[model samples]
Target: MNALTVNLRSVLELTDEQFFQLCQANRDLRFERTATGELIIMPPTGGETGNRNARITQQVMNWTDADGTGIAFDSSTCFKLPNGADRSPDAAWIQLARWNALTEAEKEKFPPICPDFVIELLSPSDSLKVAQEKMKEYIENGVRLGFLINRKSRQVMIYRQGKEVEVLESPATVSGEEVLNGFVLNLAMIW
Candidate 1:
């Protein structure tokens, strides 16, 4: 089934705590809030998509483990963006110091901060335009670098702060560049 968006724009916005409760009440579903307070209910990905997502997160987390400069998160970890949207990228990273600055309570809920680096893998059900726009939103919300990987087309879109998006076609691997400090994403499993 396709994902659904429910508009709650006319009503009072849900507080972060209220949103958390709503999510808790619906444990099996993935929920997200748009800046304007629309509730997004995402469908679970297909088996192949799930496998690719796992490999993508694994590679990124491995890099974070070795680099020791940041913490990595899989798709389930949501962040309350500065623009008021709650977003969960496919794979995300935050610098160690920045993550450490949050209080335990803040960390427990959707952390009210953007990730330093974000990646979105385009599944068959996802719209390429929407995914690219989400990547742009991450960049706008203070993420230093973002990657939009499309396995079907074998194209990857690189988004960097203050720079034009760089697109790579049929790339076997992608560099994390200065933002990730020498980490490289081997796209073999993902592709």
Candidate 2:
């Protein structure tokens, strides 16, 4: 059997302004700001991982509409955090009320607010520790819910404010609980 070679690049630490400029320059790079003020820029996904993430995002979006909660967005969209940081999740959601409260201009421009829910799909090249830290940061920054989807193990870890983190393994369904009422996503379907 032949060994597969993985090309991993060193993570470049960046300031908030530098991170913004990097984002502006590279349309394909995805950036995540760590709680300790480190910036991680990752290359775009290819092959199975990308397809799985896209399928999961679509499933979540469909579940949101079927549950009658609000709108869901794929990774292409970015959310502006309270701090001067902009990060994109694999998937995001916003309730109708909070979204409607935004001004037309705010809606048109990047909404300077945290998403109601965030999902991070793990890639082979991703650092699990870094991803989990980012998810924690999102919760601290006012994201009501977060899901860390690990494709390797096919597990979904759910995070909520003032509660213990819940790990929902494959063959189980993850629910939004009260944060997004009536929204239930089956892990098996997406995985």
> Global lDDT for candidate 2?
0.75
Best by TM-score: 1
C-alpha lDDT score of every prediction, in listed order: 0.92, 0.75
lDDT of 1 by residue, 58-129 (tens): 999999999999999999998999999999899999999999999999999999999999999898989888
Q: Per-residue lDDT of 1-191 in model 2, one digit per residue for the tens?
A: 11122222256455555655666787766655544455555677868778878877887788887876677888877677886556788889988787888898777545667888988988887778878877888888888999998878878888999788888778467787888777776676567
Q: Model 1 off-target regions past 4 Å?
A: none
- What lDDT does candidate 2 reach at residue 102? 86
lDDT score of residue 11 within candidate 1: 70
How well does candidate 2 match the true structure in TM-score terms?
0.79
Error of 2 at 159 (Å): 0.5
Among residues 3 or more apart in sequence or in different chains, the pairs in candidate 2 whose N, CA or C atoms overlap within 3 Å are none
